[model samples]
Target: MALTSVAVVLPGRPTLFELGVVHEVFGIDRTDDGVPLIDFRLCAERPGVPVEISHGITVTPPYGLDAARGADLVVAPAYEYSDTPSEAVLEVFRQAHADGAWLLSVCSGAFALGEAGLLDGRCSTTHWRHSDELKRRFPRTRVDPGVLFVEDDRILTSAGTAAGIDACLHHVRCELGAAIATRIARRMVVPPQRDGGQRQFIDMPVPEIAGETLQPVLEWMREHLVEEQPVRVLASRAAMSERTFARRFAAETGTTPAKWLLAQRIHHARTLLEGTDLPVETVADRAGFGSAALLRHHFGARVGVAPGEYRRTFRSNERRAG
Candidate 1:
């Protein structure tokens, strides 16, 4: 659907960062760069009343909930997690969804959608810190904590803070086309699309391992990414039996040897695609993917874009920066 209007709902004590993300993507006028102008409205429970935001700041929204009645997109930014949104606010989300408008929630905003019953039986996500609570409160919603955003049907939910930018840009790309999305991202000085998911940002504390372990083997694997690394060969290098090596590798990395190897290879290919002007086949060979087709298969599955498309987007960003 063509996006012409966006309505952002402000609850009590809203987070300014996620609210800024919505404004940055939709509220900005970039018509000179070929982006369509969107009618952006910031609405609250009461019109012309000051609503308290984070850090002792207050914003007076000019429009009331009626502004969101038929907007093309309805957004709820992060708010206090413990506070229950008013029923009037929840009904706005429900009515907007029923009216076929795209529904989006950033960070703790998912709770409002959940209360509105829009997230029931839908795959949704929120900030990792609140993911467990979201799941506990709404048993029907499938909360994926690993992804930057989850788009199930027309309902979209995003993780914390910067991930809100990723989700908003994705919506812009889907509705307004990649060129417009790229322009907006360039204006914001952020990537049009980021690689990996929330899992990459989550802090994983290292478990203390007493003696000599797979650290050396992992280092060797990184150094020789282009070389074939079968489990048998890797086990021999670690001076352990295949069974022991496999167990130890999984324990240390939280993934099997083959899966870990594939991840490393894909990461290496991403680096080459971003930093170098190599042919796809050459990148495949350097990253141990064997062939261009194989690289495309693995890279698309992991990165959500083909190798050539990734290169073009990366190069476009670099040129914009230059």
Candidate 2:
């Protein structure tokens, strides 16, 4: 479905960063770059009323929950975890869900969705601190605190803070295509997609420069995806034993060498498919999958579509959406 309209519910205490992420992705005017204009609405339970967001900052939304009707997407950003939206506010979500609009929650905003019974019988998550509470409050919902976000049945729930960006870009990629999502992510100065499975917290979140142990090795791995990178070779290059390298790699990148290489190869294949006319065999060679058959196996498993089908759909979507 084409997403032409978006509505964000302005809770009593919406965090600025979470609110800003939504506005950045959907509310901005990027028509010069060929992004379709969306009818973005900031709807409040009480229209034209002042609500202090954080640090005494206040905003007055011009529209009421009624204005959210018929929106293609409805968002509930971070609010106090303990706070519950009024029945009137939740009805807006219920109506949107019944209408098949995509619903998303950021951080404690999952509480609002949970209160609305939207998270029930679906896998969802919130911030780690509030995750137990979320599952406790909504038992039927499977809460995975490890991931950055969860999307099921048109509802997306993201972890705290910047994970909202990941979830939003994911939806953008899903509804539009990788091209549009990458465009927006570039404009925002962030990665186009971070796998939802990545751990929310990592010990070494940002790798050090000056050719540190794993950072330089990881850069080389991406540049050389067409080549084999066994753990022993990687450890030898990093001047560590395989056992030490394995531990540090997990701590630093949150995944093993083999798994990370596979992910990189898959993404590189996606980029090639989206931007080039390379044959499947050639693309697979460049992406380190060895052959078309192997590429099809992994790509279809991860992306839920064959390479040709993905390319066709993405190309068509870029043209139609642009």
| Cα displacement (Å) at residue 101, model 1 | 0.9
Evaluate all candidate structures by whole-model CA lDDT and list the values in order: 0.83, 0.86
Clashes per model (N, Cα, C within 3 A) = 0, 0
Candidate 2: where is the Cα deviation over 4 Å?
202-215, 236-241
lDDT of 2 by residue, 178-248 (tens): 77788889999987877777677633445333445677898899999989899989999898879878877
Instruction: Identify the runs in model 1 with alpha carbons over 4 angstroms from their true place.
Output: 195-200, 205-322
Return the number of clashes found in candidate 1. Answer: 0
| lDDT (10s digit) by residue, model 1, range 164-216 | 99899878765655566778999999867643242424556554445587878
Evaluated at residue 115, the lDDT of candidate 1 is 91
Name the TM-score of candidate 2.
0.89
| CA lDDT, candidate 2, residue 120 | 83
